[model samples]
Target: MKRYPIRAAKYAVYLIILFFILFALLRAFGSASPMSVLWTTSRGLMFLGVVVVFALLYPFFGFTRKRLTFNAAERADDVERIMAMCGFKRIGSENRPADDMLFEAASTAKKVAMMWEDQVRITTDADGVSFIEGNRKEVVRAAFRMGTYIA
Candidate 1:
């Protein structure tokens, strides 16, 4: 939950900028009066606030953790491919700290959409138990892919 505030603040900044642009466009091209545009923009911002709050909060409270176990016969390459197919890119070697493979959303647009909290860390122990950690929705999606692909 500690990360929520930072995410919210960042999103708020973006939303404010978006609303300002909308206001300007409506006033200039839509022939809307300044006060009307201001009112509409304010309402739009409020609606966005509600939506963004729910989006950011749901992962913390509403999602279940997902995990996968890969036997010795399973290759990490296959796992990487599934992750890539699911829109993840492996973190570069220089930053990887352990046997753990770190991944983030493959595209800048996705990173921004996820508010940059789209990391999915997979660390397999000697027993082949791989723990998945990060934003819940992405983890669940990746786990589902890995499960189906590796099965």
Candidate 2:
């Protein structure tokens, strides 16, 4: 079986907090017209919060990490360029065939979260380049910081 990065309790807590956030939104703004909802609704605001906060805080909490591994398609230090674009620095590289890349970054990439390490596993395929952290779910914020979120 594939091992999950987070424990069950943590997932439960994360879900509970998400529900609470939605509930709070419901309480704060539940009486909107259908037209306004079509344009932009309270639910949209909640979604924005979900993406911004989760991306900013997940690394701060040390919930996920990344590693660097290169395939035959990659050139030397290409991984470093990718990570740098994403606001990470190549701290240590093992030069091994597996998990040979290492990076360090701050949470929210604002120079905060010194206690946390922004580890990123650089995965590039024919589809596009990707950064996978703790789980299969794509955390876009943690990817290479494109403009606002991870691209």
Candidate-wise lDDT, in order = 0.72, 0.45
Error of 1 at 38 (Å): 5.4
Write the residue-wise lDDT of candidate 1 on 1-151 in tens digits. 5666776566566766776787689778976566554447876557666757765765566334555766412466887888899899888746654458888899999998877877777877777767777877788888888888885
lDDT of 2: 0.45
Model 2: per-residue lDDT, tens digit, 29-120?
97433434422977757755665556445544444444323241254355455556656665545553323445567346433333233354
Decoy 1 TM-score against native: 0.63
Superposing all C-alpha atoms, what RMSD in Å does each candidate have to the true structure? 4.3, 11.3
- Winner by lDDT: 1
- Show where candidate 2 strays beyond 4 Å: 1-8, 28-74, 94-99, 109-118, 122-151
